[model samples]
Target: MKKLLSMLCALLTAIGLPGCDYVNVKELQPGVSTAVEVRQRFGPPQHEWRNEEGSVTWEYSRQPEGAECYMITIGRDQVLQSIEQVINEQTFARVERGMTPEQVRRMLGRPASSQYFQLKQETVWEWLMERGSTLNDPTYFTVSFNPEGRVVGTGRYTKLRP
Candidate 1:
């Protein structure tokens, strides 16, 4: 169901590129590209998730030398809004106000754990990840949501390898 649509849009953004250059990914113009055009370009998305706003984001990951993943957001108008690299600090920093829980999940994968604090009336989702270094020290990202299910805040920490 959703997977098929994601794929359709991946080719939506990724289909036409002979080389699939991530650098040139910026070429996808938000105001210009239609979902059909995107499907025709990229091929199929590697993953897909729908935001609370009812719009879908299609993911495309390039493996081997280029271990990069892209999140392409197509608006209800079926026009593109943005293309983002999901695996970097810059992306992590973009976790901002009013984003939905699903958007965060789509960007960072599942959290390592989550907790609901009755005192604060919020649910916190945490992810344990490997930061900049390959030494395997754990990095953590926590996104907090209010009772209404919207993102209210975020946190991050790095544990250096000993």
Candidate 2:
């Protein structure tokens, strides 16, 4: 029975079952959920950014395997301010040339993967995005930076999933 259960779990994962690492942020009310509660539910963040207003934005990246990256903000009072899913078309449009890699990371959270091209003197970061209305269509959004570490280009591509 234990072996059978393990097999079932593996099959579910292989078929891309939702909620594997999904967090229902709607249940976490802004201005109500404390920082401690946020940490309890999401565990430690991959990165934390301190804002000028004394707020901190925590990055929870579900990458490489999962398709969403969440940015949760905590006010100076230690209260939850907002929860945003940063991997989307709107955010992608915000990326522009001359922007630094840090700016990109802040806007989009951590990427699924990064690759450096030695000859081209460029670094490309990739993020897996939602299929949205399309079925079995795996999409990837990419940001490319030049040797100076400034945004040079952005692109998107889809690979059909079996």
Top of the candidates by lDDT: 2
- lDDT (Cα, tens digit) per residue for candidate 2, span 1-162: 755644454454345443533434655689999998776566678899999999999998778667888899999999999999988889999999999999999999889899999998999999999644455577899999999999999998887755
lDDT of each: 0.68, 0.82
Candidate 1: residue 48 Cα off by (Å): 1.6
The residue-level lDDT of candidate 1 at 140 comes to: 69
Model 2 lDDT-worst window of ten: 13-22
Off by over 4 Å in 1: 1-18, 92-105, 109-162
Q: Could you tell me which residue pairs clash in candidate 2?
A: none
